[model samples]
Target chain A: MCQLLGMNCATPTDITFSFRGFSQRAGITSDHSDGFGIAFFEDKACRLFVDNQSAVESPIAELVRNYPIKSRNVIAHIRKATQGKITLENSHPFVRELWGRQWIFAHNGDLHDFHPRLSGRFTPVGNTDSELSFCYLLDKLVEKFGYHEPALNDIFTALKEISPQIAEHGTFNFCLSNGQALFSYATTKLHWIVREYPFQHASLIDLDVEVDFSEVTTPEDRVAVITTEPLTHNEVWQAYQAGEMILFQHGRPIKQAMTVVERLQREAKDPSLKRVTKADQY
Target chain B: MCQLLGMNCATPTDITFSFRGFSQRAGITSDHSDGFGIAFFEDKACRLFVDNQSAVESPIAELVRNYPIKSRNVIAHIRKATQGKITLENSHPFVRELWGRQWIFAHNGDLHDFHPRLSGRFTPVGNTDSELSFCYLLDKLVEKFGYHEPALNDIFTALKEISPQIAEHGTFNFCLSNGQALFSYATTKLHWIVREYPFQHASLIDLDVEVDFSEVTTPEDRVAVITTEPLTHNEVWQAYQAGEMILFQHGRPIKQAMTVVERLQREAKDPSLKRVTKADQY
Candidate 1:
């Protein structure tokens, strides 16, 4: 299993604070420490930093923690090397350009035997199942709508329709963004929180660090943070129900859809595969 | 025009020393200032950093100058934006994955009225002639050799043949690499230097910096540095010919080819465009 962190905000917000806590999972707090990667979007352009080294000690990860590269949409991952070798190419938070917009993606859970036929349009450079899924999704998007890019809602609709097929293979929790909006899907574990006006102090669960958000943010600023687990202990983080997909924009969850996890549970080819339960609900 | 810099070496080497001097051209030493970018390859994986801000003042550039990220091949660019807006998407040192390998490219010259028919296998993320050229080259390479990546010599042959077709539009000096070999094509300006066992002292032309290579390198270390102009004033740099393509491997020029600049000169479709000359040789 890997860990994912995503942020979408109304204004450009520095993720250094959240990243510092989330990155601790790479080695210090927990052990998902095969590799780490992060993508910061400035408008349609993205500055992606990926290293095969552990995030706790990687110089690039240190740079990311210290430098405040503000972005409306950001995705990060700390890998545990479930499916690929620990190489720079295998690190998560993969990037590709579609519709003249750079799309970034990061995955958190493993997809067992999930190999979809790629259209050779958006091929994976690395041999990771995560990257393969991303490529397959992109190819499907391109296939559904030719040359020109469709609306975001249409894309979400297409993604909603196709995500279950991949999810059926195994746990498929992922965060994807095109800088305009962030789309997150979960068949297993995922949590989210929105920090807006009247933001309060929060303490990191992994580190003995606390931050008073009021001191650093304007009243108009709003931030949506999604992660495998809640980074802060005090904040009321909302856990995604199994087989739920949510679209986050302007620091809030605006839309959601349900998958066929229940239907698949009723008609299970493998009884042990459907691991959803009441605990998965928010 | 933009300024291009590339490094290919026998061993992994940090480029902070060269980058410090080269980045100075973004604002302080010379003005190619619109944006800047650099791409470093670690095996088949790449770490690409681009900024719309001038390298002299960009914090990311400062980080690059301070951090010792080592690589065997690197491509850097400082833009004097002639074709596109000064945006991150339009920054040079564009990257794309081809044949499971990340291909990096940076250009120093322009291509006028040059829009080739894209096969949709590869597309430009940004609106730059440099990026278009990179895409067209990749698409053509894929078309010529489907699925499998070809040999370095075959790639050089294909590049040697395809380069002139793009160059016919305008000046098209560029550097491209796939972590295996560095391929450089020159129509107007490009210079290269190789530092080996018997290294000597060299001083940057743009900065008051000097380094004795013998103290920092081993007998086995070999490095080939290519730029739009010689980065160091004291080193004997070899300039690329008017229409020449060189494939550099293991820090040395291993193969070379000549383009039809002379033929274009003989049959000038536009009298104003034929700028090929004996002065181009060094």
Candidate 2:
């Protein structure tokens, strides 16, 4: 399985320290060295970089480690080939234009036998199931809400209604951004934490490194980090519940929800659930 | 680049709703379909899955979208090839044994000429810098503290000292876990957020999905999410400062630090910094 790294903060900050430890797993301490990529959000757009090299050995990775480019939102990943071939075209943290803003996405987990028909609005650039689903999702959103962006609450309600149909296929967990807020969801595993004033020292599990946050950030700066696992040795990291969804903005979660297990179980017993797919029109 | 999905809460909650939306990018909406993987932490260990396919097309990803596996800590990623060929050997959320516990890691960004000498304490199973770095980090930690695990704070301090040296070689941003807390850092870009009581509805940028968190979570449940970018449409996401480090435990940022730009500038000015490499070691 691949690993994920993300950050959301009230102020622009770099992730050199945590990234140093996290990158070690790409080839040094663990597997997951297929390829790596990252995106840095600068307002409504992002600076993205990807490499079909391990984080430990890739020349580009070295530049990231040494250079400190600050941003308010970031997403990154290291590949462990699951579906597509190990090529630059199939990197994670995919970027797209939506509502006049650049949206970024990354995913973990797999879906089996999920081939959905799509219109021309959004399409996959690669042959990964993850991208296909992303396109289908955007298509549905535009179809439902049109050009004008809807209120977050309204969109959330629609998402809850549509998610179960997709979940029937397999494990699905992901992170997404539009240079504004972050959205996250999980079916199997995902974790996160928020950092604010009175920051202390943190150490990495993968690397023999530590940093004192209090010395770097201002009292007004707040940050939230979401990853597939805990990145620090001395900090509190929270876990996501099964089938929960969350939204974050201004370094804080603004929305969240849990799947209805009973409903899902009922659907499992019904043939109607099996018919849900991208083929079904919204 | 890869994508990350994470969730953290005061209490165990399901992430199906969010996962459904986020997973779509793996292949359906975005292009991270090289391979997909996820890890769910129950207590100390994790349930992990990886597929060399897009989450949108993979039945496994679909199942993830529907399944409601509950956990407090979780990590997920979608790969885009960079170094190693797309194969199971290169899958992420790489796990290793440390102090009789499993450690997980995922990374984004590339490294340049980051070849460190290994002492055999940890070795690379894949041909990517990510794994090599992981092993090197563990080796360093073990070398510094021996078999017994040191205090998280001490580990953080050590990591701080070691990260810059490694980062000097290339870009380094990553997420790591030792079954205790989630650690994250970035040299370029990363963002994060926290969610607590009174969660509201959230919409996803990649999918037509939304959820009303207030409907499922309790007021006591606090969650922190860190990512490469913000994941929601309405919530505020904070960005990391240039060369910042942080640690997360219990869904909160307990520690953080900023990179010493002055020191880095001095290092850049000194030709000696260029001579620092594995060849110069020992």
Candidate 3:
């Protein structure tokens, strides 16, 4: 398992507050101390910083915590290394160019025995099931839209249709961004919160740090933060359903979808496990 | 014109000392300061930091100067923005994925009216003639070697054949790396030096900084540095000819190639202007 943090804001903003809390899980508060990486998107261009060192110890991660890099979209990951070895080549989030736009992605859960065919154009530089799935999704999107970049809604619909096939393999919680918007999907655990005009003071759950957002934000500012778990204890975090997908833009979710239980029931390889899931949901 | 700095070393090494003087040229000593970027390679993985702000003022650049990030291959660029606007997208060096490896490049010269036809696989996100030439070169390499990666010597030979075609447009001095070896091509100005055992004192040309290298390095340590201009005045720096290409690996030049002067002489559109170059030699 891994810890993921993402932000999609209406205006350019820094993630020092949230990232500081989230990175504590890398070594201090939690034990996901394999490696970590983050990506910040400024319009269509992006800057990515990755290291095989733990986020708590990496000097580059220290720069991220102290420097106020303004961006509307950002994604960060702290790894526990379930599928890949602890190496720089295996660190997330991964990036590739498609339709003349850079796409970034990070995964939290593990997949068992999942491999998809890839088009020669987009190949994974590192060996990870997450990277393999990312390349597969890009190849499928290119096949769907050809050389032209389609509308955001069209992409959302296509992702909803294609996500279940990958999710059936195992836990498939992930976050993806295309600079314009962020797309998040969850099968096991994920939570999100939106902060707007009437901001209030919040305290970190892992560390003794507090901040009054009202003093730092203007009336026009809005932001959405998503993560593997609630980062702040006071804020109301919304958990996604077992199989749900959401596209976030301008600090809010613009579209949402879910796989119906009947469909999952029909697609499951073991019918007996579906009955167990129904009992557990109660 | 921009300034480029590159390092290919036999072992993992830090460039904090060299970069301190090199970054001083952004605004303090010289005025090539449109923006700046640097990339460090750790095996097949990389860390790229680019800022559209001048290195003298960028806090990220400040962090770079202070942090000792070690790598075997490093490339840095300070831009003057000849063909592209001053923005994050237009900052060099540009990156692309080819044959399942990350390729990084940076340019130091201007190209006028040079746009080569691109095959759809590799596209330039930024509007720079430097990026255009990089994509053109990668496309030609892929066409020449299909899916399999060729031997390094064979690739060097192909670059020797293809570089003159791009250089005819104008100055095409650039450095490229694939995490394995560094390939440098120059048409106007570029210099390189190899530092090994029995090192001596060196003084920076642009800044009042001097360091005795003998105290810092071991007998097994070796490093090759390539730059647009010589950084240290006291060291031996060899300049590349009008059209020379060198491939550096294990901290030394393993192969070299030069384009014939007769070819460049024949390709020049203005025949009567050759006398100006004759005076430069004197």
Candidate 2, TM-score of its B chain: 0.89
The two-chain DockQ for each candidate, comma-separated, is 0.54, 0.01, 0.54
Which residue pairs in candidate 3 have backbone atoms (N, alpha carbon, C) closer than 3 angstroms, thus clashing? none
Candidate 3 docks at the CAPRI level of medium
Count residue pairs with overlapping backbones in model 2: 235
lDDT of 3 by residue, B1-282 (tens): 899999999989999888989998999999978999999988877788899999888887898899898899999999987887998878888888777778899998877768787776677777888888898898899899986888888888888878877877788899999899999998889999999999888999888989988998998889999999999989999999888899999899998877646444554866754532321221
lDDT of 3 by residue, A122-148 (tens): 777888888888888888898898878
| Tens-digit lDDT string for candidate 2 (B1-282) | 777666655566667766776677777767788877776665544555556667777655665676676667677777877878776546565655555445677776666788887655455555667767777787788889877778878877777666666676666677776656777777666777887777888887777777788987888877777676667888898887655677777777888866445345666899576544432211
TM-score of model number 1, chain B? 0.92
Q: What is the TM-score of chain B alone in each candidate?
A: 0.92, 0.89, 0.92
Provide the global lDDT of candidate 3 against the true structure: 0.86
DockQ of 3: 0.54
lDDT of prediction 2? 0.71
Instruction: Compare the candidates by lDDT and give the number of the best one.
Output: 1
Give the interface RMSD values of the models in order: 1.8, 21.5, 1.3
lDDT of 2 at B273: 60
For candidate 3, the per-residue lDDT at B133 reads: 89
